[model samples]
Target: MTKTVAHIEKVLEVANSTSAAALSRLAASWRRSAERHGLDPGEHRGPRRLEGTHLCERLGAFEKLMTVAAPRLDNLYSLVGQSGCAVLLTDDDGVVLDQRISAADTAVFEAWGLCVGADWSERHEGTNGIGTCLAEQRRVIIHRDEHFYARNTAMSCIDAPIYGAEGQIMAALDVSSARADQTEAFNRLIGAQVAQTARAIEEANFRAAFEKARIVVAESDDAEAATLLAVDDHDLIIGATREARRVFGFDPLGALAPRPANDVLGRADGPTGFEKAERAAVIRALTRAGGNVSEAARQLGIGRATLYRRMKRLGLDQT
Candidate 1:
C-alpha cells in the first residue's frame, strides 16, 4: 500500500473510533475535519481561492490589519525565510491577505495553495495550521503527517490568531515550511515567535483604534497575555484588549459603558462630598495659576479674600 493510502486509513481509523470531545486537540480537529467538515483524508484537490474581485473586496475590508501586520510579517519572514518557510497573514475567515516568501520558494508554496487569496479555513482546507488556529482561537502547530489531508502532509504549519481592537478574532499569522528536514523542536521555537508577533500586531491595532486615549497595562498573573486598557482624560475606561476585558470583567463584545478607571482598577477614589469637590477645585485652580492666589481667585470667579478664606477652611493653609 502507498504511504498516502496508509495515512488515510490511519486517519479514518482514529476518527471513526474516538469522539471529538474525548480526543486530544489534534484528534478533535481530525474528527471535525472528517465528520463535521465532510473532508476526505485522501482528497488531493488544492485549496479553494477567492476570485480577483472578491479577493480585492476582502483585502479592502482588511486594510487596517494588513497595514499593521506588514512590518510584523516582514520581521517574522526575515527570521524564518532562510529556513525555507513562508509567512502568511490571513483574515478572520482564513483568506490569505498578505504573505512574505523568498523568490526561490514561491513556486513551491504556490503549488501547495499557500498563495494570497487562498482559503485556509478548517471547513475548506481541513485541519491545517491557519485554519485550525482560527477554529480553536489559539496558537497551533500542525507538523507533517499530522495534517488531515494527505496532500498537505508534507508541509509544517505554525499559526497564531490575531485579536482585533474589540477583542474579536480578526486575523491569523502563519509560518509554513515544506522542507522534509523540518523538526518538531524547530517548529516549537518558530511557533513562539509567531505567537509573539501576533501579539505585537494586536497591540499595534489596539493602540491605533484608541489613538487619543492613554494605554495602560492591567496587572495580571499571566504577563504574556496582553491585558491593556485605554483611558480617556476624564479617567473613564474607554477601551480594553481581549485579555483586559476578561481580567476586569468587562463586556467582551458590547460597547464599554465608560466606567471610572479607579472603580475598574479597584483603586480608592478618595473623599467624596461637596467639601472635597470644593477643595479639589480650589487646588486645581491654584496649581494652574502657578500658586498665585490672586490669579487663582480670578480663575475661580471669587474675590481674593473669599478664596483665601475658603482655602484656609479647606485646610490648605496647613499645607
Candidate 2:
C-alpha cells in the first residue's frame, strides 16, 4: 500500500474503537499537505442537454448564472476553512456544475468520486448530500447515519437546492465533509447561504424546478422573499413560508419525504436519467467490499484493496 493509504489505515485502526472525532488528527495532517499541493476535487461540468444545436440554449442561461454565483460562493467557501467543508452546485438533473472545498477533506472527496463532471442522480449514485437534496426537494443536512452509500456513512453532508425565476428546480447545492467543528449551527449557516444563492438565481427565472428543491433561506439582508417548506411524497407542506406554499404545489397537511429533483418521473422499476454505470459500479463495490471497509468505502462496504483500486482509478490521494 502507498504511504498515505497506510497512514489513513492507521487512523482507521484507532477509529475502529474511537469516536468519530478521532479522525480529526488525520484530517489535519492531510489538510496541511493538500494545502501545499492543492487537491481540487469536483470537475467543472456542463449541463446535461438534449442532443442538437440547442444544447447551448439549454445551458447558456444557467451557465451564466453559475458563473456569477461562483465568486460569491468562493467568498462563502472561504469561511469553510479546513473544517472538511465541501460545496457543490448541481443542475436539476443532478449533474454537478461546480464545487469548492477545504483542503482537509480533499482526500476523502476525491475518493468518493466527487469531481465536477460527475453525475449524481439518485438511482445511480444512491443517497448523498447532492442527490438526496435534489431528490427530496428539501434542504438536508446529513451527518453520518443518514448516508445512502454504505461507504459514505462516515461523512457529514448538508445539501440545499437552488431555484430559477418561476420556481423550477434549477439546481442543488451541497456541502459534504468529515472533520472537527462539524455542528448543527455550521450546517444551518451553509444551508442558509445556499438558499440565498438559489433565490438570487430564481429572481432571474421562474421555470426553475429542483433549483427550488430544498433551498434554504439566505440570511435576510433585507426583507427576504424566500421560504422553507418540508415535504414528503404526499406534497403536503409544512414550515416557514408563504413562498414555500406558493412555489411547491404542496398540500397544507400531508408530508412524506420530497426530493423533487429525484422524483421518479419515468419508469419506476428501472434506473432514471442518472442511474446507469454508476449503479453497476456501486453494486460491484459492495460485493467486493465483503462488508468490512467502512472508512475505506462509503456507508459501510470498503476493503483495503477496493479502496486502493478506487483511489488509483479516480486519481485520489495516494495516502
Candidate 3:
C-alpha cells in the first residue's frame, strides 16, 4: 500500500510539473495525459457505460469486424483467462465491443468496469492499457499503480492495437489481471502474446473483408510477421495489412485503396492493359506448379510456347 501511494505521488509530481524530460518517454507521456485530462490522483473515476440505442448503434458499426474477430478472441481468452485475467476487445474509439471473462472472474472484473459498452478511451479513463495503447499506437503494459487513475491501481494490463486491412487501428485487444505484484517480464510476455493474437485477428478480418480478392501474403524469415495484401480483379491493391504497409513501404494514411498493385509491388514494367490480370493468373499457376513452365502452361489450358510468350510479355521470362 505504501509503495502504491509512492508510485502515485511520483506520477502526480510528473503530471503537475511543466518542465520536460522529468520522466522517461512512456512515464512522461502518461503524466502529460493525466494533466491534459485534468485527472486527480485522489479520484478513481468509474467507467462510462453506454446503453440502449447509443450502445446498439456503436456496436452495430463493428458488426462485420466483430464477426471475424470474436471466435479468435475467444481462443485467446481461453489461452490466458486461467490466470484470473479478462480479455477485452475495444473498437477504434476505445469502447469495449466484446469481452471474455470466466464466471469466476466476472464479478471481480466488473468491479474494475471492464464489461462490454464500457468506455476506456484516454480522454475518459486517463492512462490505461487499452486507451494508452491506442493513444500511443503501440503495444503497452500498464501494470497496477502505473495506471494514471488511482482506481485502476489494482489492475495489471497489457494491450496491443489491432489494425484493419487499410492499415489503421481497427480495435485494441487487452488482457488485464486483478492480481498484484506481477513482474515486468511477466507483463511483457503477456504483451507479446496479445500482440501475436491481435495480428491473427487482423489477418482473419482482412481475409473476410476481401474474400474474393487476390490475397497475397508476404512473409519475412520471422514467419510470424507475415503481411497480407488484397488485390482486386482490376489488379488494384484494395487492402493492405499494417505489416504489409510497414514492410512494403506503402502509405498507411493514403486514399481508400484501389491503388495499382504493380506500382505498389515494384512491377511497373511487368504487365499492361487487359493482360495484367492474365499475367497474375499465369504467375499464380506457375507458383503453384513450383516454377515448372510446362505444368503451369498445362494448368492454364495453354500450350507451353504460349505461356512462354505471355511470361516474356510480362517480363517474367527474363527473371
lDDT of 1 at 19: 65
Query: Residue 45 in model 3: shift from native, Å?
Result: 3.1
CA RMSD of all predictions: 7.7, 24.5, 5.2
TM-score to native of every candidate shown: 0.83, 0.46, 0.80
lDDT of 2 by residue, 72-165 (tens): 5676677664566777777787766677966666777766666565666654444466766776677777665444334555667777676543
- The candidate 2 region of ten consecutive residues with least summed lDDT is 39-48
lDDT rank order: 1, 3, 2
Q: Give the worst 10-residue stretch by lDDT in candidate 3.
A: 267-276
On the 0 to 100 scale, the lDDT of residue 231 in model 2 is 25
Selected candidate, larger TM-score, 1 vs 2: 1
Which 10 consecutive positions of candidate 1 have the poorest summed lDDT? 266-275
Question: Judged by TM-score, which candidate is best?
Answer: 1
Residue 289 Cα positional deviation in candidate 2, in Å, after optimal superposition: 69
Q: Which candidate is the best by lDDT?
A: 1
lDDT of 1 by residue, 72-91 (tens): 89999999999999999999
